[model samples]
Each structure stands twice: as C-alpha cells, then as structure tokens.
Target: MTQTLVKAPFRADQVGSLLRPESLKKAKNEYKAGKITAEQLHEVERQEIKRAVDKQIEAGLQVVTEGEFGRDWWHSTFMEHLLGAEGYIPEQGYNFSNQETDPYDVRLVDKVAYNPNHPFFQQAKELVEIVGDRAVVKFTIPSPNQFFHPNIINGQYKDFEEFAPDIIQAYKETIHEFYRIGIRYLQLDDVYLAVIATADFPPEEKKYLAELAVRVVNGVLEGKPEDLTVTTHVCRGNYRSDYSFSGGYDTVAPIVFANEKVDGFFLEYDDERSGSFEPLKYIPKGGPRVVLGLVTSKTGQLEDKEAIKARVQEATKYVPLEQLCLSPQCGFASTHHGNILTEEEQWEKLRFVVETANEIWE
Candidate 1:
C-alpha cells in the first residue's frame, strides 16, 4: 500500500550536494588563484549544474538540485551570504571521525537579516530555468539551529531569547523569497539536531537542547506557504566520508518527530551508528513522511538491493510502508571537498535507490 506523492520527498530522493566534477573544481582553484574571473567560474558552475541535473533525471530521480556546486562548504556559503553574517578562518576546522576539515566557519557581525539579493536567489533561478518542467527543483540551506554551533562567533545577540526571533524572521523571509521564485521544494540541511541528539549530556540537559532545537526549527517554519514542500535532512555529519557524532536517535526522537513543523524528514539511517527504527514509532500517523536514508553515500560500494529492501521492511514495523521513502544517508558532497567516491559510483548508488524503490513502492 504505497502512497504516491505528487509533491517532494519523492520515493527516491537525494540529500542535495553531489560530487564536484573535476572541471568545476579546477575552475574554483583557478578563480582562487586569479587565473579565471568570477564570471568565468560561474559559467563553469552553470554548465556542471546542467549536466548534474540531466544525470539525476537520467538516473530516474524526480527531483533535481544544483548539487550545491556554487560554493565551498554546504552550510557556510548560504550562511555567510546573509546580510549580517561573514565567513572567517577559524582557529581550527571541524573534527570528523579520523580527520579535520579546513578552517571555515561563519560569524554574525550585526543583526542578521535575509538578503533578497542573496546569491542563492540567482542560483535557484538558474536551476529552475535549467530544470524546466522535467523535474522538481529543490533548494537547500542550513537550519537555523545550525547557527547555534559553538564555533559560530555570535557578536550581535546576547542570549537565545534575543537571538532566536531574528533567525526565525530571517529564515521565514528567505523561504518566502524562494517561493516567489519557482522553487516549491525547499530542504533545511540540519546537522545540529543530530549533534545534540548524540552529544554526551545529562538527561535533563539533553531534553532542554532537544526542545530548543524543535523551537528554533518550528519558529523558522512558522506561517510558511502551503505550497512549499519544506523538509529537514538530519545528518550526523558527512565530510570526506567521515562522521562527527554517533549514537541512537532514541533520546531526541520523541521531541523531533512529534514537533518539528516540516513536510518530511531526510533522516540518516545508513549504518548502526543511527540506531534502530524503533524510535520512528513516535512519528504520529498523517505527520511528516519519513524518507529513510538506508543507502550509504560515504563509500563507493553499492549495497545489496535485497538488503536495502529488507531494511525498508524492518522500518515498516514502526512506520507504515506508505509513509516511507528512500535516499542516501547524506549528500555525496556536503562540502566542496566531496566524498572519497568516484562520480560513476555516486550515480550507481542513486540508480540503485530508484531501482530498489520501484520494486518496493511502485
């Protein structure tokens, strides 16, 4: 009894960012070295994005993204583009499982506000023009909760109470701006929720953080247009195939599943670090549809088709099959560095999701 969704969170969706093609990577480096102009770099991005969209459709995906090809880091690019936020080289980079990332982070210099002229607006316009009507165009941004990261230097606001509303207003305005354009599918890529979910904290402290996470998310989502298919992709961190946190969703599931005001959830469940599906029971009937990230994007290895199907069947114990969809654990490239997998392998993985989903849901 699979229910067909005309909106997004498609049966076979993706977590947005894709592997950066070598040409675009080279162009980025050339621009950095002043060998190529910004205009030239953008032209290459446009070309690569077109090719990426075509491949996504060719792989049988109904939704297409620009592959987050226009920037260096997935979250920082969008965040720094805000009116009052700026990028800075931190003392250190984020610590992933066995490695450290490049030192890049965002900081607020003044009161944060949405910029109508943000580069993302132009990026979304180009994406819609390139995608045409063949597939839905999905635009992704970091969640407001992401701003609460300890690394992000906050210079304007004093406390959560003073800070939360402005972030909420900024996000609400940004969403409306996207809606004004042709984007109907918008996703907030959230790693903070997962960070708090698995962080070592006392029971009461964890509960407070989880509740605060929901409030920030819902505040940003308040009064969003009905036509916008807003979803949140929860990740435990996806950088160079390295992860940041590990633990079950057992503690935060009840809070997130029952409250976050979103159309669906792109949840990471590719490995044991994500824990069991028992927490999915907290998802009330008729609430957000769960797009299961059962396929791993960390490596080039393709999972057994039957094993993925079996995992989906296992998830059905808590959530009905009709309420479930499929995707990779995270994007192939959450950062411009991309993952350690070949481009061909990324497509192969996506094709597997489409093919496997067809068998189970179609």
Candidate 2:
C-alpha cells in the first residue's frame, strides 16, 4: 500500500453567520434600524471572531481561519458595503435554483476602480494581527474574473475574452496588496472557472481562457515573498444552501495544472459531479500540494474512509501521494443560512477527514 500523510483537517470557510450566534444578528439589525453605529457592528464581529479563532484551535486543526468570522459568506458577501455589490440583501443567487435567502446580488465592480481599504481587507488585517502566530491566517478573496463572468450582477460581458487584461491587472493588484499587508496565505476562491470550462469550446478558446486565468492569477502573485503560500479553491458553486455550476477537471485540467505558482489547491472532489480523476494527470507532479476536498461540508452524511483512500490512490497515479492533503469540498456555508447539516454533524464529517487521512497516509 502507498504510504499516506496525515495532515490536520481545515475548513475552506466556517459558516460565519451561523457561528456568531443569533444574538449578534439581532444586534446588527438593531444597529441598522437606528440603534448602533458601524463601530458597534464591528465590535460584535470582533468579539465573535476571537471566539471563532479559539474554537478552531480547539478543533484539533492547525491551519485555522477566523471561520471567516467577519465575512457573511465566502468573500463575496463581505463586499457589500465597499464594492456596492448587492450581496447585502436576500436574493435568488445564480446557484440554488429554487432557494432564496438574504443574499447579495451579483457584482459588476471592475478592477480599475477597486479599493483596497474596503471593509473586507480592513477587518482581515485586524484579524491577522489578533490571531498572530496562532494559526496560518488566510484571507479568501473573489477572483477578478467574477466581474465579467456571465450570470453575476452587472456581469455585462457578452464575451469573456476581451475582459482578460483588466481582470489580470485587478487580481494582480489584489495579491500584491494582500502581501503588503503581512498576510501570507491568500486563498483565491474561484467558482466560475469550474462552471464555464466546458468541452464545447474550441481548443484555442479553451487554451486562451486557461492562459488568461493562469496569467492574471500569477500576475497578481508576482514579486511575492518566497515565504508566502498561495492556495486556490475551485468551487462548483455554493450559495444559499444550493449548488451552482457542475463539471469535472477534464475540462479545466492541465489548464489548471499549467499554473504552478499556487502552493496548494483546495479542489472539489466530494462527488462524481466533479468528474473522474483522469484529468488530474495535467497537474505537474510535486508542483503544489493538493488538498482533495473529499469530505463534504454540504450535508449531514459522512463519507466512507475506504472509498476516500481508493480515490487518493487513483489520484496518486497522477500527482505524488505525498503532495496530497484533505479538506471539505467547500465552505460549510457559502452563505449565512449555512448547509442543512448541524454543527455536530459538521464536526463529525471533519473528524472523518482527519481520521481517514491518518489511517490511509500513515
């Protein structure tokens, strides 16, 4: 049997809106309705974030985040006040077809006028300072490409090709900005890349998009300190308790593999909807660590360890087994409503990931 490595289990994002407890939201509403100032809103978030960081450490996790404590969901919802993205309100998102929640609307903001001091980055800086040296402080940001992607709010693009350069510049600026802030781990949350990549596109078109994505992503990452570790998390789509785009690595493979800058990849492989492991061949062996999102945070059920091990083996045929890691497919909650699973069930799933990883890799 191939030897496996047991690394600590980590979450892409902890359901922040859920973690803060019901009292916090009530405070937020009271403040919004003429009871509190922005400072109060932030104070509550700060208190909860501290609690969140402590709990993560207790979870037997080494790479802990503030559970994205200040963020409502993913990196998008946090953009409401700054970017003017409509995510602050509850609306029907592109994913979760029939479901609705107090969600933000699609974003149309461009990279040209983007501001770095937005609340998202501002509070993130504070969180890093507070969590100092406790755990790897990670900031998850939306890829610039989301602005031009079809279906998002203000995504006026009829053709994505022309939008490439500005997108690159925007993302490049973002990475540099984050690095300057003393942040080391930047998790680029990309959802559209998984959905739009399809077999129908001509090879040239596919290659062009791939090149653009890799180029812009890497461009933003250029000149970073060697000590930094960049991770990219590819999501099919996680919205108000719903799925968005669905496909496999076959379409984006090798294209995804083409980029070698990111130190780790938190990829979705929780179900067959992600496609077979065959496309994994494209990833350059031993390039970056691969965090196989085998344990799902979407539902209450636990995955079988035996099956997970087999999948890891199958994947090893492409990338080195030593280069692999484990995690949940995506955030337990990309939105405030969170998934259908209870907190206990979520922990059990995470327990399964760590335990299964230990048994296989050790």
Candidate 3:
C-alpha cells in the first residue's frame, strides 16, 4: 500500500460538518419552502462554502471540507442522491436525548450507481477548485455499511448476500469518480459500525455483524488509488448533541484493526461513554494510524490543556505517539441544524484542538 502524505487526518483534524451560518441556514429553509429559486440557493451555498473553507484555513487546520453545508443531514442527503434511491420525510422521527428528528429516509427505487452530475460531486468539485492548493480538500460520505440498516435495506434485497454486491459496486464507482475529479483525501463517516460494536448480542452474532461491516468497507475500498488517503470515522451517532450508542472499540477493534484496508481510523474517544483506550492495542505497529478524538464537540467549554495532555499520554501507552493524532469527539454540526453551541464556541473548540496538537506534536 502506498501512503498519501497529506497534512490531513493529521495530528489535528475533524470529522467534517461545521455549524451552518445563519445566511446559509436561511437560504436552505427558503429553498425548502419554495421561496427561493434553485439558482439562488446554489449561489448562497457557493459563497457559504467558500467562507467555511476559509475559516478552516484561518483556524490553522491543514485539511478542510465543504463543511457539509450543502445538505440538511449527513447520511440521507448523500443516500438520496444515489441513482436508484428516492427519499421521504417520515411522519415520525428518531429519538435522541431530549430531541426527536424528522429525518428523511431513502429507499431503493432502482439499482444504485454514481450519478456523475450529482449535486454532491458538483459541490465537492467546487470545494476543490476554491481551496486551490491552499489546503488539502477533504470530502466525507456515509459508508456503504451504513445503508445496510434494516430501515434502508430490508425492502431492497433478499438478504445481505444479495444487497452487498450492488452497494459495494456503487461505492467503488463513486470513489473512482471522486479520484477522477482531483479528490485525494476522503473520509467515510460510518456511525452504524460503531453502533453495532456497542450492541449487546450473542458473541457469534456480534462477530458476524462486525465481519460484514468490515467486508463491505474493504469492498468499497477495493482498487482505490494508493495516493488517496481513505479513512473511516466511527461515530456513535451525533444528532442534536446526543449520541445513539456508547461502548469502547473493544468489540469491533480486532475485526477492524486487523481486517479493514484503509489508511487511518478516526475513532471517537471524547468521554467516558466511549470507554477505554485498551482496544488501541489491537492496532498493528505500522500502516493505518489512529486519530484520537479527545476534545468534545457536544459542549463549548474549553478542555484544560493539561488534562488533554494527560489523556494523550495515556493513549500513548497503547499506540505509539507517532501513530496518534487528535480531533473533537465528532463534528460540531453533524446536521445542518448545528450543534447546541454558539459559532464562536465551535471555533474555540477546534482552535483548541489545533493548539493542543501543536503543543504535543510540535
């Protein structure tokens, strides 16, 4: 495997999706209400994305994303755009802490394929053009395993065996298209695998689920460009500052650490809910690195520099310091509604990650 030497998934990084500015938020709402033209919405998105990219650079981040401002939520937005999929706003919503979200869900209306003119591809292209070598432009998408959830998969295929190949091919084609468009850094935001890891099930069942997740991910990564830095972010589900699952990497570590073919693992470890660093021992001495998320995005309060340092030191006990990096537990805004913090607070948290990373890795 050839390593891509980009300053991303670096000693300092994030899980993409930043809080949408008020202007962008308003424009999105207006477009939804049919008050604004698609052309008008596109113009606003372009300007806002440019500003978001500039903010990443200003904050001392070497890697940047479009901040996912073009979409309302992470997973469904991308899924709905797939060639064979159609989305719907359900009457009810999923629960998370004190909140419930009226999420849009996707169903396969036909066989899936990459639509070259998909809005996300166009948006990613624009992001690459705007960054213009100023920083490494990163694009994030939901992992293929994510679509395997019963909510998405049940009606589409007879079983995993039947569904896997089509989705895997779609993702492979998508990755190749992304590479063709000058995208060298890509992150797969996969919250489902982490959720599966935390579930209480028969040992055999857990192992089976874990293995299937790894299989689909590795399949999606098949034949990827050696110079492309493909990483997976295992989210425990971040919506309105609440999580859907909680557990250590222990259950899935052995499977993912040993089996998955990727460049790095962006593992969440911001609080006690995620459990211990013991699973890091499964990581091989070399190859994929670990980007530890010790900072919190759920709240705006700055973490003590000394405390974070202590955690980094503790993590070094499992994985060598050279193979480690830092980030917030998750994105500040996994959805466009934004997290429960002020914009200034969001920047402060990210800036702190940069400052803390510099102190340790400098």
Name model 2 segments beyond 4 Å from true: 1-20, 78-92, 97-103, 106-111, 150-163, 198-204
The sequence of per-residue lDDT tens digits that candidate 3 reaches over residues 209-270 is 88998999999888898889999999987887888787788988999887888888998888
Looking at model 2, report the run of 10 residues with the lowest lDDT sum.
Answer: 7-16
Which pairs of residues collide in candidate 1?
none
Residue 298's lDDT in candidate 2: 73
User: TM-score per candidate, in order?
Assistant: 0.98, 0.84, 0.96
Local accuracy of candidate 1 as per-residue lDDT tens digits, 1-362: 23267977889899999999999999999999999999999999999999999999999899889999997899999999988899999889999899999999999988889888899999999999999999989999999888885446375877666788888899999988899988999999988888878888898988888898899889887888888899999989989999998988899999998988898998899989999999999988878989999999999999999999999999999999988999998999999999999999999999999899988997
Report the candidate with higher lDDT, 2 versus 3.
3
Candidate 1 weakest ten by summed lDDT: 149-158
lDDT of every predicted structure (CA atoms):
0.90, 0.65, 0.85
lDDT of 2 by residue, 1-362 (tens): 22132222232222122333455667777777988887887788778778767766555555556565566666565444433344434344343545544535555544333457666667678878878887767777766555544544355444555555555665566567667777776777777577557436787877777777777677667777777777778777765456766678776777776574777777888887787777777777767777888877778888787888898888888788777777788877665556777767766765566667666666
- Count of clashing pairs, candidate 1: 0
- Number of the predicted model whose TM-score against the real structure is largest: 1
Which scores greater on TM-score, model 2 or model 3? 3
Candidate 1 at 113: error in angstroms? 1.2
Sort the predicted structures by TM-score, highest score first: 1, 3, 2
List the candidate numbers ranked by lDDT, top first. 1, 3, 2
